[model samples]
Target chain A: MNRFDYIRPGSVAEAVAAASEPGAAYLAGGTNLLDLMKIGVAAPDKVIDITRLPGLDRIDWLEDASVRIGAMVRNAELARNTAFSAAFPAISEALLSGASPQLRNAATVGGNLMQETRCAYFQDPLSRCNRRAPGSGCDALEGHNRSHAVLGWTPSCIATHPSDFCVPLAALGAIVEIEGPDGSREIDLAALHELPGSESAGGIALKHGEMITALRLPAEATSFAGHSRYLKLRERTSFAFALVSAAAMLSMEQGTITEARIALGAVAARPWHATDAETFLKGKKAEAEVFAEAAGIALKEASPSGDNAFKITLATRVLTRALTLAAKGTPDRVPALPASVFMSSEGATANA
Target chain B: MTLSISLSVNGESLNVPLEDTRTTLLDLLREHIGLTGTKKGCDRGQCGACTVLLDGKRINACLTLAASVDGTDVTTIEGLAQGDTLHPVQAAFIEHDGFQCGYCTTGQIMSAVGLLSEGDAGADPERIREGMSGNICRCAAYPGITAAVLDAERRQSESEGTSV
Candidate 1:
């Protein structure tokens, strides 16, 4: 909201050129960017609006049914896309399992990927946040650390990447198509985010003035009937940030798990890939007991904070429930169903 | 730094000159355009207080930049009612008594209009609830909002004599 020059450039070259300024940022759907600007979190000298760029909002269906989703595709569009909904339901479900309708409509894929951490201390300019202002002293490390990251977190930063879509993308190994001073390059989405404990220099992978062009996903990214669900556990259900979220993708063959890609969110600096759990679930029969065991494998070595110790237990429960429901994969449901808060509500009422 | 933008609001085109910085679509409608029907609740996207139809899609006007919409069509809550006649969504809201203080009424109505246009079937209360979750009424008039959206959907289906 501060006095800054804003330009709506039609071409990517012009937009990138404008964004190359010392203190300039590309504005997509300003749902996140403008909010930060208003709160003085992002103080850009010049704002480049590139939401109007043509061909940037496309969802290209490549050969063999692979998809290349443009960066500017709105969250709502990605959620409602029939092809994505059918093929990689996790990606579609991830997009739908985010903010409200208005926010999704105005929030672009690029903006969502670039959305800053949702740590209260980081957003509050008055508060000290290591992520916002390096070495400002992280208040959340000891102060109201309920939502702070438990895994892959260091003393420097405890903030988690507040994105639901990235979990599925990371687990599926989606490639990020980027356009910057250099030509386009398809970088692995999993490699795009960095762990705070990275001793390597240039901690963040996404460079300055390098706009996201598109996201390409393989055709066989997920099975056609692969059961997947994004179960998010939070303080409140309707519209609250996640405390512990789970994205479980199950590929079963004859009641046996062929592959299980489980990603944990809101509990780590990035989508915590449950590699051990996934490896244990492979070739095992998909059952309640197996799910419980897999969930245990996922959180066995979890290092929860003082206040966030509950997340370990909560995430285990969520993953168990998600895996159970995903295994069933039933569509028919009844309304006004008689259901316990945490109990299974299947077959509570007739569909009709 | 001033920018002149034209918007086709409510079936009418209006050219408004705005300062290069600061003013939003919400302010343009409420202050400059003098269409105060759209209530400003949170001045943020959290509350659906400034919901408006931007090219047939619902978006928080507060989050929208005025200069961004150079030649886009916008429909505010005031546009839903045609002088004396109200749209089907508006009529359903009236019949269901979907408002209280009427401050959040405009935003609720605009959101309802967009939600119904989303082509969501199943007139059940739960479906309607999930669809209209963006609109928050401090008056606790959520039941009415759900009922209105369901009622509007029902009417649309009844007119077709088939499940919509």
Candidate 2:
């Protein structure tokens, strides 16, 4: 808290206009912005909060069998939605696995997708990160890089994109609807994020002052059997960041794999699309051996840090487990993970 | 610029001039509103030391800007007991020895109230646990916290049965 201006806009247009103001930022859930403000990492002269914007909080079930989630809809609402839980358990699980309860309640769908990378250097004002300030040397590369990116990393930065939703969305082929000062455009979710190597030196490619309106999901019929699975391996059982994660979507008929979609997290500068894994998996039969082979193909190019080298092994196990479980249509629930992960009672509770 | 924030807190309508200069609702409630029952530990949203009910929904007041809560309703830990009578959640916490240092007790109780208010959809212990993960207690009193919630649920069920 510094003395900054706050404007609660009544309409999306008004919110966008306010956001386009000089040095203005959009505030929806306030989880990410407020956290940044407290530490002086993000200092917007004015904030245009769109939480009160009308009609942007609805989860619309379309005639096409797709769910269009308004940008302002809470993460918790989406996570607990019956349709989402049943049809997209992996996506729902990923949402449930992220952050904590209060955060999910306050975090909006758009906010979750667009949240910044959690590089310690980026969060701390004292340290330097190219993502935060281009040309400022990245302290994370030579420093505690255990949480840094192994793939798609550049000479400039190794910060991992810290969203639990985006990785699965990339696999499920989710689309983003945004309206900027220029006009509105619908882009595939993959278009929203840029790899570190190709990113512009001055700014991220998400564009300036564009307001996300809604997320459009592809119908199940469009992408056949074996929906998707968001598999995250964290240091702790819950309330911790993913060490190495994968979102797997297998397309199979009569024990023969027709297609596969695998995405990696925590180990990449962006949501790592394992097309190699998908390529290796296609034409293979549904079995533990084939899935393990695909995992190896996915991780063949992975390069890990000194401390995070173990994550390669753990990630392989995660990918294998996720593929096997997802093939059986029994993706593990994040809430009720096996008790072996909890070392103490402190690990066990929290829901409000 | 002074932002005029008005809210109904535990049935009483109160107004406060909150500038961005002030700390969040957790700070305003404890310092200005004199409702010290809500605590602020991590200042960040990571710790649930400042859990409160925002129009029946649970939120970390520390992350919530007080100036943004115009015309909204807020319920804090102090509002739980009506007069000398304790709400079942409050009583359950006390009976279960839900705290050692007790600094985070108010937040824990407030979180429990929030969970109960969430109704049947959030009645599952797993759901409740997922919801309340934001609040952290250093004393490792989660077992008591879980027991209090389950106890409160049991008492409510029993009372409902007896009346029926």
Candidate 3:
């Protein structure tokens, strides 16, 4: 890790001012930033610690029943919050599915949202990754691209965002509140992250010195909150990043879907919100065949690389299973494929 | 820039005057404070060998900057035992042979203690295994480790019931 100056700003204004400086990065939970620094992937000249900033660690309930979670609230705290979990079980399940109990105890909402991709090439300084160095080239495009993106990927980068929280947030239509040098603004969670389009493509759409203050989960007064699910498929049972994950929420009235929201992870540069599939599910019966059709529509635009071509089929199956589980209102059911399934020639042929 | 920070480590308040702001909590414990009980397996957060309780929450010390933890209380593996009497978690580990090489013992013990306090470790073996997944035991002492954690949790609850 490179040597740098550290400052714990007492106020959000002070933190924003410090962060606006060149080579400055906000430090909260340090779970991802510090690891990136250790690998020489990120070398910020100044790290402004924002964990101590006032009023950024509380989980508040609004009159409208919406929950406001501070940016500095640790993942463990949010996952264990009874009210938040009651309101948004998918969010709780997503948070618990990530990292470990130790890491979740320290990782914060804002830090998780701002985490860099876990693309091997992007983490390796020796590899030519366009995200690491503009116009350098992308090694993952041809070399060991099993975990590369299948959607919203450009030639400059084929990396997927490795966040479990964002997928649920996108499906739930959560809003992000950010404070910047100019003032404050709210951005829909789905619009917060951007896809890699070119060599200069950025991951997050935050302005300079803009720090995430809180995330607002809209009220679950509707039926969707009671019928939401998050399903992550990973190599191992715990402490592993997602190979393919899905978050689905549905509002059913008399066994028919009134509304549906779905998002896919580990297959795109950002959370792949299945808008087309969501539209298709509305007013349709909550059946397995309907879910399978929606899942197929969701992956219709997926363009997979050589090794990650499996993700398209994996994502479809995962999304279909997730939607079926959501319709049944089972938020904690995690369906994972065996490791041998990915290695078997028959599995590849069937998926292909 | 050298910054002076106060940290309460293992129930002792110490003022550390440091020159490098890049010093991690793991380095401060092992190198500066001379608490070798906390092992540094991976300087990064991948390995949980440097696990410690920051304000009663388990965190990877290697990923935590010492300066960022100013005015915070940290509980390390050395802090678990009172005098010569070992903590219940520590005792259970010994009773169950929870370690093979024992290099990951400190972190495993610290993480178990933290897990017990968090009330996430029930009597279920799968839950204990998942809760302790952060700490990697290269010797594959997972069965023993799981048994030790569950046993410790049972003992702690039994003692609490008796006292009540």
Best by TM-score: 3
Give residue B22's error in model 1 in angstroms.
Answer: 2.3
> Which scores better on lDDT, 1 or 3?
3
Looking at model 2, the pairs that clash are A350-B129, A350-B132, A350-B133, A351-B128, A351-B129, A351-B131, A351-B132, A352-B131, A352-B132, B48-B135
Worst 10 residues of 2 chain B by lDDT: B119-128
Instruction: Determine which window of 10 residues in candidate 2 chain A has minimal summed lDDT.
Output: A338-347
DockQ of each: 0.54, 0.55, 0.55
Candidate 3 colliding pairs:
none
Tens digits of per-residue lDDT, candidate 1, B49-150, equal 899999999999888878787899999988887779988988988899998888888888888788777765367665566566677889988878778888
* Fnat of each prediction, in sequence: 0.50, 0.57, 0.77
Provide the overall lDDT of each model, using Cα atoms, as 2-decimal numbers.
Answer: 0.78, 0.76, 0.86
Residue A296's C-alpha lDDT in candidate 3? 99
Candidate 1 per-residue C-alpha lDDT over A47-160 given as tens digits, one digit per residue, 9 for 90 to 100? 788989989999989878778999999999987887677777766666766777778888998887778888888889999877777767778877788877778777777778
Model 3 Cα lDDT, one tens digit per residue, B27-89: 999999999999999877777899999999999999999999899999998899999999999
- In model 1, the runs with Cα more than 4 Å from the true position are A198-204, A330-352
TM-score of 1: 0.94
In candidate 2, what are the lDDT values of residues A1-352, reduced to their tens digit? 5667888887777787888877888888889989998898988888888887888899988898988999999988887777666666667777877887777879999887778888888899889877787778878867887877766666677778887777778777788999888888888877777766544322235666798889988786236334556777777666777888877777778878888777777777567778778888888988999989888888888777435677777778888877876676533344443211231122354332
Q: Which residue runs does candidate 2 get wrong by more than 4 Å?
A: A198-204, A221-228, A331-352, B119-131, B160-164
